[model samples]
Target chain A: MDRRTPVDDRTGRRIVPETARRADRPPTRYGSRPTMKDVAARAGVGLKTVSRVVNGEPGVTPDTERRVQEAIEALGFRRNDSARVLRKGRTASIGLILEDLADPFYGPLSRAVEEVARAHGALLINGSSAEDPEREQELALALCARRVDGLVVIPAGDDHRYLEPEIKAGVATVFVDRPAGHIDADVVLSDNFGGARDGVAHLIAHGHRRIGFIGDMPRIHTAAERLRGYRAAMEDAGIPVEDSWMSLGATDPERVRRAAEAMLSGPAPVTAVFSANNRVTVTVIRVLAEQPRRIALVGFDDIELADLLQPGVTVVAQDAAALGRTAAERLFRRLDGALVAPERIELPTRLITRGSGELPPAG
Target chain B: MDRRTPVDDRTGRRIVPETARRADRPPTRYGSRPTMKDVAARAGVGLKTVSRVVNGEPGVTPDTERRVQEAIEALGFRRNDSARVLRKGRTASIGLILEDLADPFYGPLSRAVEEVARAHGALLINGSSAEDPEREQELALALCARRVDGLVVIPAGDDHRYLEPEIKAGVATVFVDRPAGHIDADVVLSDNFGGARDGVAHLIAHGHRRIGFIGDMPRIHTAAERLRGYRAAMEDAGIPVEDSWMSLGATDPERVRRAAEAMLSGPAPVTAVFSANNRVTVTVIRVLAEQPRRIALVGFDDIELADLLQPGVTVVAQDAAALGRTAAERLFRRLDGALVAPERIELPTRLITRGSGELPPAG
Candidate 1:
């Protein structure tokens, strides 16, 4: 059964829209588009004449062609290029399904993908999954319906079995930043585990036995991997960990602020912090700024103006644009049949230190 | 003639790949999409059976449908939804043409537009003009060829008469961030003049007689408008401005650093600087950080983490997301048959004071 969602208002309330799209989207129909017939009617020409004008085929008189062109212009008629392309066998465009466009991290990544696509003389269609599994499926399927030549997906859902059908049908796919769930396709990932381990280890190296870790929800693979890295770092140092030192959930400022405050005032207060990602790092920076103690810190992901702040933020940085570029290149390779097997490639991370990670632990 | 770009290689050089999008893009044959006929051939099923399976029509047994589906999957056949949509008058999609998706300022704005589109059960197709007028025209026309229901444009071109045909053909458009040039359309803009005037006036009131202004290229309407505001503020205070105090050009870091250095070391060294935009402001901040003397600054457009700095940055803040939301809402209203003449809507900007704007003139 085809599924439809209730429209959301500005306040997040569900409301029925006055029919922007139909609910019974049969395989035979999707949305409306102005066709050659509309142009013919507006131009006072026959269907064949309009088609001739659209196709640039000879035989139609110049005057009649002009009239059809005017009608096409006036009616905003768009020739069904998708239908014609069906016979040709390639859509010179690709789909990019990312987690969210609003996130600063993804903006460069998306732009890099767009640049690569442009250089390849192809257009790009982008959709944000908004971190919803259903939304991801709906968007990916919608792009398939448009018949994009290839797809670059940053998977929001663990199970991408639904995409198997499309992939088998010649949709070259490459997963970026994260792995596709249950799929054996080309995947490009940063060394999240190694980067997190090094960042936490940097904090541990600065004479800090007690360290706090703030991360995203455990459900996210990256977040879980980062947590595992923290565990490994602590184990390597033979330092006992505390329950109060670990906090995992959304990257919302309020939650992160509370987490930082709790760890600072906990039974065994942490002397240092290892922020797992950019969002968490930003909030921790704010929290540490307001507190009196000097908390040594190391964060994953580089941020704008990181060097300007007092005690410039130390970070384990991953190249977002590079990740996108590599994945896109691989996606094109698959389309060109240059690649033989589904490969997993992991890029390295770099740790930058200025003031925070090198700070001495406060008594 | 239909235009096509050759694909680019990783070395930042252009090279034709083994095969990609065809060089020729006849209006009639944009790109090819897989068809159901190919699927039928692959499955060894009759065309009628394939049709029945695709449409989910009854009478085709489950076994036969499975075979047809397998063929469909293997063939990468995407049901031609655009062809079906031809009978309808709306595509339930909108196109957004912005400067660059990689820019931090546009991320929230694009997200807001997408939110509005989603609220109306519409999808968004975005194209970056990359600040090139020709590219802007190409991207806009391409979106029109796809028959998007509406358009939200952040125009890079000074002349947009090319869009007249599309607008006349019932493709509703709303210009955001910048006014449409050589064309009449609904435009939503921030009060650039008022905001700049206020920002510069704040610096003047802080006991500064000589203040510097660094802005973007004069060709951009916002840059020129902000410059005018700066001049007006200086004239209103009866403070004659020196030509050496004003630097206008690209907002790249090296140029801005040079401009700041020149202004600070000029014969009549400025006591303060009023930066025209976020990019300039960020660069100026970095330059000022290295100098021994403190130079007070008030910038247009707020920066993230502005408050957490040693001295919070005061800015004349314009709501980017609000501009996008308003423009998208107005575009949908036009689609809903709002029969009104094009009107210009200007949203107000707020002056935020934290520390920088309130600084005393340094000795």
Candidate 2:
């Protein structure tokens, strides 16, 4: 009754029925080999017991389960579920599509999604769209074709009508950090407008009338929202925003550096500056550091070592991790049979004044 | 004969298929359902021809390909490979298991692996082990159950014999940043020992004999190697090592601060400190800034804005992105029919000497 005793002369390799069948039989079903069920019937076991052991679910006694498991191990049994859909119909996997994986902003967001997915006993399949619309569509459609149970998207493209069919087919979708255009979906976002408004208002509160705004391209949703916040803050203070005071362009270091310099060294040099995002913030900080250290600065999005700097740059901090976590949670909830219409979840941002925001307007 | 004409009722609401199956007997697989054969039949071609069109493969005639594509789109024929895979043996996906996704080191690594996976037209499934051995095994086995084509592991545990079966089943694996124990596998590593020795020797050459080494836990491979390098450098310099001069513990900022304080304020204060990693280095820099500006410092792992500080921090810089890219490239090469035994690849690290490393020993 020694189960592991070798039955073959092939170097202690057990002579399992399925292994023999695989060697003797030609490939069947479009060149796909037989699955675990084929092996299970050949070895003789209840389907539920085989499934329980395969999924590592508890219930069966060790001895019987061990035999079943050994039979599975010997046959090289892989569960082929295309022919059998479980009652739950859950794949225990999610998809994350973001702007760029290499970008520091999206890195934490992707990690956050993975963390939540792991906690829920799910796997994450991710891709970067590189901000290309066609690529975005391709990547998204590819994930859909793979039948990922849910999706958490940091959308690069505004329109997502391509996702309509997949969404209808029960693939729960949640947008993170940005909304999907031309589609209604659950979206989790940071308070970008409020963050930007507070950042600008902080500089104005520090006695700066001529405050400059440095932001990303105007077409970006977050960028547009931040610009609107800047305008709202200025309007609330009864200060008309001058056309020359706002600089909207690419967030590349060189461009941002020039923008910061342009506003700082202009006819009426702005006493304070509001940077829209972390990249723009870092670039502007470098530019400010090159100056006489008299101009005040407040940046949106908290960065690492922000408190360790010379003046300790102040910032309006949004929880990037929370944005990702909330979106993923909603996505899973939808997958778990929540059929409610789409809703927006906005997380608040906090202004942390750490010396730089407290600086007086340069005279 | 035009399919564009909608047979709408007087209510003006368009009628759509409500279930996957119906009584229409529309010659579909299950009423309005489209299968590969259906597409092929409609296009007057073989089943594989429609598969080629669905998979975006070249070689289909424009006229017939358009007809097949139209049939696919009109019927919303989303490919269900998950079901088809019950017959097919291989899943075109790979798994990436790493320490923590949130860490700056692994973010780029994950992205690099993702790029390689995408280039090979494969999807990537990833999980973070969070430095837990059990979790690592759990995640690894989960991916195996899903039958991924291969794995790229940043191993959290030394022993990986549990992965022997998966590897034997032809799941190609490559370890990055660390070597796998109890398993002979391909590995990509930075030259930790040499880098640490050079960093310490640089501090010693700047006229410092009493150099403190603040490193991560001794159990970690890199930390242990770096500590050995520190001892070797001290021995080569004919400097007797004092037990208090080295502190090996967790890399958390609080523990690092205490370690730095022990070296700085003790009876026999070290003239210089060699920090073993970026987190420890940053903490030590903060601690040094509190004291008199006399202590020299050399840190392992270059960080952003290292040169921006008053006395620029010196570091042994390892190209993290390069490590990732090389490892991923090797992995995909193996997947592309390169059947070779596992080999180890070591990337070199360089020590950059700024003002901090050149400071004279404190009086």
Candidate 3:
């Protein structure tokens, strides 16, 4: 089945389920306004003339323009921008799909995208997928229906073949933070594997023999890559991997607290912990605070005020805004007539050490 | 001049300034894709029937819909939701205007707005005003031209009378974080005055006779309210506030640092400080850390990892998400046919004492 089928197809419109449910509702009381056609008729001008005057396109003479303008003001016509945007092609808008807009990591990322879109004179429409595949698909298709000029997606789904149809239908697509699944597309990413590896190595280099890893669900690409990085660092140190040292699941504070506590429970507790993301790192800091002993830490993703904590949080800092900037710039590049095969672009991460990563293995 | 003018008045069309600049440029290779009319022609159906099938609107026989769907697929016709939404009235989209999306405070707040919009089956188009009135007005008007169902604005400009035309034209608008100047409208705000008063009083109760106040530009409503609160607290405690005890300007770190250092450099420095915002508070924290004496601080807005710091930061916290959620819910309530007069809403603030707010007057 075509992915761009009727909006409410089999699954119903995830976008407007209520509208689909109450399809017969009358237009809102305030919605009975005039359209461009009304302005055209009122001004005794052609439809195209009304469109031109409303869009500010330069073609009409001064006197004719004034008459159209007068009619527009008299009738309260709004140019039907959606219709104008349709007839003209190119919406001058882009859509950004992400896991959560509220997450600190994505906030800068979203801002970066907006900055780039502004530079290109385009507006941005975004929605959170909440890390669900179905939601991702639903939101993505909704934007497609809106006919955005392009799309920047932070993937949640394992398979994105559903997007193939939209991509073919003239929508520019770029994936960031994580690569698209089961599809070849332009992707901008932080070197998750390398970043995690470096964070783990920093702990091991501090003379911590036993170390723990806390991360998100293994199904997530970044989490899985971080786990691999941890193993690689341990293997390089000739330390045997311990299943008990790894806990991967949700990044909620409670879950992370439990994971960190469990890892510190055994007689062979880890002397240090490598947190795979900012949320996990934050929770781990609280968990360690309650413990009597100091647990060394090296976390992925630097956070605000990380440098002011007791030991200061040592982190592998990935530039989220840079990722977004790079992806959006590349998208505009594609829109500007650069035809090339889709490729993956990975930006490097920096290790910022104030003190936490430098701590020796605790007694 | 008409607000929607800039397009060719009688000439017939516009909206692509860059395109108009290079009016001679070729169509994008992907720009020749078939439109809804093309699909209609192939499906041998009326334009309305094609729209009905595309939007999943009722009254379409299955046979006609199937033929339309086939034509859409065969011709790769992606529905122009912008146009369809115009004909139907109600675009199922809202606009959000704010200071900066990258700011941690707004990240969650914006998310709350998006969540509410999603539940109502609408998309959110947002732009950062960068604290510029002109930029805010520009962004707001652009979204109006796009014909969003409603707008949630955190005003960067004091006067919002410019939006009167749009609001009168049927856009449901709600002011957030800051009230609209010169316009009567629905406003949802944190108890800026009471919160600041209580926070300053907390410092005075700890025997701090001379307390400094650091805040954003005084022209901002919240900042002015906070200063008022600070003065009220001082008057209530019978302590006189000195000129050196107040600094109001940009919240940039360097300026804030200079202000803090300048205040502390006096012969008789403030024994405590009431930071009026998170940005100001974070900067003051660094400055105080460098000084030899202990400086009690009570801040508005909580930061990430506040509790993890050596002396946990004390704060009078206003729920940013609640501010957003309340504004959004109220916006939807207006859209849902509630005919109520515009009113002001104030959500309460809570003071949380950690270690920083309890410091004694020190030399």
DockQ each candidate and list the results: 0.17, 0.19, 0.24
lDDT of 2 at B171: 76
Q: Please, what are the lDDT tens digits per residue for candidate 1 over residues A18-86? A: 223234422322234467778888888889888888878989888998998888766557666555554
Model 2 vs. true fold: TM: 0.87
Instruction: State the lDDT of candidate 3 residue by residue for A182-290, as single tens digits.
Output: 7667888787887888888888888998999999999999999989989988998999989999999999989999999999987889999999999998899999888
Give the candidates in order of DockQ, highest first: 3, 2, 1
CAPRI quality band, candidate 2 = incorrect
Which candidate number maximizes DockQ? 3
For each candidate, give its TM-score against the true structure.
Answer: 0.82, 0.87, 0.88
Q: For model 2, how does the per-residue alpha-carbon lDDT over A134-157 read when each residue is reduced to its tens digit?
A: 888898888877778889988888
Per-model TM-score (chain A alone): 0.80, 0.84, 0.87
User: lDDT values of the candidates?
Assistant: 0.83, 0.79, 0.86
Highest lDDT: give the candidate number: 3
For each prediction, how big is the interface RMSD?
12.7, 14.6, 15.3
**What local lDDT does model 1 show for residue B125?**
82
